[model samples]
Target: MRVQNLVVGFGPQNDTDPVLNGVSFEVAPGECLALVGESGSGKSVTARSLLGLAGDNAWVRADELSLAGNDVRGLSEQSWRRRRGRDVGLVLQDALVSLDPLRPVGREIADSLRLHTRLGAAARHARVLEVLARVGLSDAGNSVRKRAGELSGGQRQRALIAAAIALDPPLLIADEPTTALDVTVQAQILELLTGLKRAGTGILLISHDLAVVGRIADRIAVLSEGRIVEQGPAHAILTRPEHPVTRQMLAAIPVDKPRGLRLSPRAAAPVSPAAAPFLALSDRADPVAPRNTVLEATGLVKRFTRPDGTEQLAVDGVSFRLERGTTLGIVGESGSGKTTTARLALALTRPDAGEVRVLGQPFSAASEKERRLLRPRLGAVYQDALSSFDPRLSVEQVLRDAVGGGRTGRGAASASAATAATAATAATAATASAADRLRVLALLDAVGLPQGLLGRRPLSLSGGQRQRVSIARALASGPQILICDEPVSSLDVTVQAQVLDLLDELQRNLGLSLLFISHDLGVIQHVSDQVAVMLDGRIVETGATARVFAAPEHPYTQTLLGAVPRIRF
Candidate 1:
């Protein structure tokens, strides 16, 4: 596959401002070429142009564009469709969105074989299972019957790869394929791609993660603002980058850094004077001094009844204490009970046995009324910020509602005002309204978001912006403890860096306790003061982050560390 002077643009007059401007690259047989850049850098647009899947509004042109000796430029929709599965296979990033949720995964694979090959029903079925197994799905027979939603993150990714490679196309295009996967699963996917390359298949890999690119790429092209800023051997580019953009991206990686060290060079927004008191509530004392325990769980055991009527233990005898003004990172594979433990900590899910205490008081075992009063002290930020927000609410509305709904002081005052004068009640309501607005604005500033975004809905915001809003919403409740579950998993490295830096600053200023859960060990090492490794619904290892990463005692922890992709430099 080769491209020279490729240009792609959208709208009526696309040539005025193209997304991909004069981009050129090549992927030879038995080799892999990677396009690395941040989001909106024309990586996905280039892939789409090659496959003729660029949207209807997009106009693509190239001085030379060919795949397997056939010119791909100006190909009709029907011709491109004919060449797609047989000539090239495309593996997208989000497998959950790519695969049909209602259909069995095997059918998705079989459809490709049925379209590209002259195979009978039985042959297609056998080929589906064969590819599934080849992609490392353990129980291919049973897996074929499961829908995409039924599978874990790694399993769904494998299913997507299985469908993409069923026809054994000469060229494969993987776009952010490992972006959402855990370290070990990402390593497996990288290995699979490497194996495919060794089999004489040309691969075009697109990713924002330089570490992942450095692991598998033979050649690397650094894309910046729709152009290739630097192109060379993978080792040379990663070890000694020439472009400023490349250097900035490398510096943004969170690995090999100590806690509280900023990942990005940008400074965090200062806390407003009005919001200062709220953030500094716990900051009055020495931050490094021996602090009290903010949250604790003892012998936590949670079970769920499966569809087959068999109970599955989600959290088994989990126990941990989160100290004030510190971070406790929970690291594990997809179904290792990391999220379940977080839910148990938040008191969102009740444990069948055991107890949780917040601020040295009973939490999980308390009544709903008691929990409601204490709820203002805790907040949560989830992985999918867009999905977590209400589509109907503007940014201002979301933050304002959070502030008004969770203000324990206001609630108590309102209860006392039931017998107070009506004029006094009106005055109090007006005062609260003004305070809520000020708090909302301050929250936006705290997250480095512009006040102009106040009127926009969450769906219109970018991935990073949505996450910032999520953080701001979590802060609006004046929570001393923040439960962040894979909060930065979906973001690109640079944005991830900024969010990490912001969290570090917020924690330092607010003295907040963080129960951070993630599958990314690099992020865990960066943000966590203490680390807990979970496996099979239990905590396998727990220690200081530095100690755990330097000298992992458990075999599982060692495996996770070994699988982490790292730049040679």
Candidate 2:
């Protein structure tokens, strides 16, 4: 596959403002060529142009574009469709959105075979199972019957790969394929792609992660602002980078960096005193002691009923303590009970056999009325921030609602004094409304957002901006503890670096205890003072982050460390 002087624009008027401007690259047979860049840097646009999947408004122009020695410059939609599954296969990043939700996964795979090959129904069914097993889904019999939503993140990604390779296409395009996968599962996916490369298939790999690219790429091309800044062998570009953009991206990685050091350029500046006051909780007046356990769980157990009418233990005998003003990182693969343990910590889910205590008060075992007063002191940030927000509400409304919800004293007045009570209620409402507005603006400032975004909805904001708003909402309650579940997993490296630095600074200024959960071990090492390694619904290992990573005792922990991709430089 070759692309020379490729240019793609949104509309006819955007000829000079093309999304991909003069981008050129080549993928040889039995080779993997990586395209590395941040978000909106034309990586996805370039991939789409090759497959003729660029939108209707796109004006695509190239001096030379060919796949398998055949020109694909001006192919009609029907012609491109005919060549898609037979000659090229595209494995998108999000499998949950890529695959049909209502259809069985097996049927999704069979449809590709039915479209590109002349196979009977029975033969296609057999091939579906074979392909599923090939992609490491060994229990293809059960996986074939389940829908895409029923599978875990890794399983769904593997299912997407299985369908893409069912026809054995010679050219493959994978776009951010391992963005949110665990280190172990990402290693498996990388191995599968490598196997395809060894089988004489040319691959175009698009990703923002330089570590993953260094592991599999034979050649690398760095893209910035719709142009290729550098292209050469993988080793030279990673180790001895020539372009300033390449160097900046390498420096932004938080793998080996220590805590209290800034990962991004923006984080070097001092935190504003005005912003500090908004993030600080009442506990900031007291000095934080190392032994103060702010959140703790003992002998926690959670179970779920599967589709087969069998019980599955999601969390089993899990116990941990989070100290005040420190971060406790949880590392695990998908379905390892990290998320369930987080829910238990947040009191979002109840445990069947254990109890949770927040600041020496009963949390998980307490009734709703008993826990309501204490709930304002805890906040949570989820992986997908866009889904967590209300689509109809503006940024100001979201923060105001959170601030109002945290106040629990508004409804305590008696109903006996009718006229006087009504006048008092009116005055109180006016005062609270004025206070809420000020708090909302302060929350935005604490999260480093501009006041211009107050009127915009969440869907209109960028990924980084949405995450910042999510953090602002979490801080609206003046919480002493913050729970972040895969907060930066889906962001690009530069943006991820800024968010991590922000969280570090917030912890310092607010005296906040953090329960940080992620599958990326490098992030765990950078942000966590203590780390817990989980596997199969239990904590297998726990220790100081430096000690645990430097000398892992458990075999599973060792395996996980070994699988992590590293940039040699």
Candidate 3:
């Protein structure tokens, strides 16, 4: 697969600028080529343009385009349709969007085989299991029968990979496969891609994570403003990058290398011991004040009944407290119950034992009336901002409903009056009128979202902007505690830094208690004051942030820290 003088964009639109410039590169057959850039850098557009998947709105032009030595840009629509899956495979950033949620993942994988080949149902089923098992989804025969939601994040990713390779397309283009996974799972996914490269598959890996690209790609292409700035071997580009952006990229890969090369300037905020508690340290600071206690969970436990007739304990006997004005970071591996703990704390799910206390009252066991009373005290920020928000609704509507102040749709004025009537009872506790609309704008500004975004939907914004809006929505409820789960994972390092700083600033100024969850240790170290290491449905170790990171005690904790890549000067 090779791209020469390839240019793609929405073209010079009446309002918007062209999306891409003259982009050119060549990915060798059976080789891994990585395209690295920040959001809106045109990397994604370039990847999608290869198969002419950019749609009619896109004005794409390329001097030369060929896959497996066959000219692609000139193919007729019918030929392109036939050639798409059978010859070129694309793995999108969001697996849920790419794979139909209504169908089992197995049949989804088998669909391509049946469509492009003469394989019957049984043969296709057998092939699905074989390919899925090869992707490390073991005993996939039963897995193929289950719904896509039934699988874990890792399993779901493996299933998607299996589907992409099922038809054995000569070229596999994966766009940010590990964006949604944890650290360990990310390592595993990278390893899988490396193996695929060894199997002589042409892989076009597009990502903003330079560390991931450094680890996987044989060659690297740095795209900026829809144009290639630098292209070379992965080691060369990462180790001694020539382009300024490439240097920024190498410096941006999280401190995961464990050793070698000194970081330029300083990338992340200096780890602040004064911020929050973390890891295995033994200093118990006085409990943050009552108004500060936004969310607290004691002796929380959650168990799931598996299809295998066995009980899966998601969260077990967990205890944590978030006070106003601080970020409490939670770090753990996949299936280690991190997410379950988040849900338990929020009263989003029922816990088998223990109770959630929000703003100083038992929450999880609250009656319907009790919950309604405390509804305004709770707010949540999710991982994927795009799906969490309604596409049809504008940003203002989302915020209006969240703040419990307005009726935003057709009968907004009447609805607002009605909402005011029902909210009158809860209103007596706090602000009587409703949450201040000015505060909403303030939150948006704090998160770096523009005020103009109020009229636009989530789709109109970039990934970082959408995430900022989610942050704004979380802040709109005026909750004492804000639970953020991997808020920055979908963003690039620079964006992640800005968001973290914004969160920290907001934490201090607003006296907000934060329950933050993430798989990145460096981020955990920087963001948390107190840290708890959870593993296998249990808190393995909990201590002061600086102490635990300085010298971790638990073997599991040490193993995790060891897995983090480091850099040397």
Candidate 4:
């Protein structure tokens, strides 16, 4: 497979700016060619153009585009559809959004066979199970019946890959396929791709993760704006990054940084001591003896009944403590109860048996009334912020809602004055509106967002921008403790670095405690002071971040760390 002088643009007008400006690359048989670039750098557009799926608005043109010695420069949609599954397989980035939410996993995989093969129902079903097992989803009996939502993020990703490779296509175009996976699962997925490459399947790998590309990619193409600024062997590009953009991306990785240091260009400045505390819940309490422990949990146990009516323990005998102004990173593979533990810590889910204490107060056993009172101090940032956010609401409204009923009370008071003094009431409403606007501005500044985005909704913003908005929302209520669940898993490395830096800066400036949960050990090691390795619903190892990473005590912890691909350069 090869491409030369590929160009793509929207609208019929040739004068319009093109997304891909003469971009060219190739993937020969048994070789993996990676296209590395930041968001909006035409990587996805280039991949979609090959399959004639760049949407109606796109106009694709290439001087030469051939696969398996067959020209495909300007194929019709119907022709491209016929060739898609038989010639090229596509594994998209976000499996959750890509896979059909309403259909069973088996049906989704079988759709590919139905499109490109003449296999009957029984044979297709059997083939689906075989492909699922081939992609490391061995529990095809159960996984086939389950919906995409029922599986973990990594499992969903594998299902997508299975569907892509179900017909055994010669070319595989994987666009950030492992973006949302944890380190261990990512390693497994890369190994699977490597096997496909060895099997003579040419792979066009598109990603922003250099480490992932460095692991399995044979050649590298560093894209900046709309062009490939550097292209060479993977080792040469990684070790000697000739392009400045590539160097910038390499420097943004979290592994090279120390704890409590800023990775963003805008360094954190000390907030005024007299400034109104935002998300500082513990400080408002009556002065007492200084306590180091901010959050603690012991003997936490949660059980769920499976579809087969079998009880499964999700979190068992989990205990840990988080000090004030510190981060505790929980690392583990998919379905290992890491997310369940995070939910339990935030009291988002009730544990069957356990005790949770937050800021020296009983939390897990607290009544609804008690929990409601304590809710103001607790905030959370989820992996998918767009799902958590209200699509109809603008960024400004989202932040204002996080401000809570206080703003509503002000509006109510202003309305009450309308009957007495119309002019004065108008003035009061204006004042209240200005105050709310100022508060929203402050939150945006803290999260490093431009004031221009206040009117935009979540859909209008990019993935990284939505995450920043989520972080701003989390900080709006002035919470003492924040729980971040895979906050940067779906983000590119450059954006991820900024978010990590922002969290560390916020913790230092506001003295907020963090419960950081992720599958990426490199991220955990950078942002966390203490680390806890969870496996099979239990804490397999716990220690200081540096100590554990330097010399892991448990084999599981060592294995998790070892799976993380290092950029030797």
Which of 1 and 3 is the better model by lDDT?
1
Candidate 2 Cα lDDT to native: 0.88
CA-lDDT, candidates in order = 0.89, 0.88, 0.74, 0.85
Q: Encode model 2's per-residue lDDT on 380-476: one tens digit a residue.
A: 9999999998888888888887877835222222244334657878668667777777777888877788899999999999898899999888988
Expressed as tens digits, the lDDT of each residue in 403-495 for candidate 4 is 643455322234456556778677876676766666677777777788899888899999888998998889877787899999998788888
Which residue runs does candidate 2 get wrong by more than 4 Å? 14-16, 122-126, 268-270, 285-291, 406-430
Off by over 4 Å in 3: 11-17, 100-129, 242-244, 247-295, 304-312, 358-379, 386-437, 477-479, 562-569
Using alpha carbons, what is the TM-score of model 1?
A: 0.94
lDDT of 3 by residue, 385-482 (tens): 99998898888777766655343342124444656665664455245223334555555555656678888888988876788788777866565567
Model 1 lDDT tens row, 151-175 = 9888999999888889999999999
Candidate 1 clashes: the total is: 0
User: Relative to the unseen true structure, what is the C-alpha lDDT of residue 468 in candidate 3, on a scale of 0 to 100?
Assistant: 74
How do the candidates rank by TM-score, highest first?
Answer: 1, 2, 4, 3
Candidate 2: RMSD to truth: 3.6
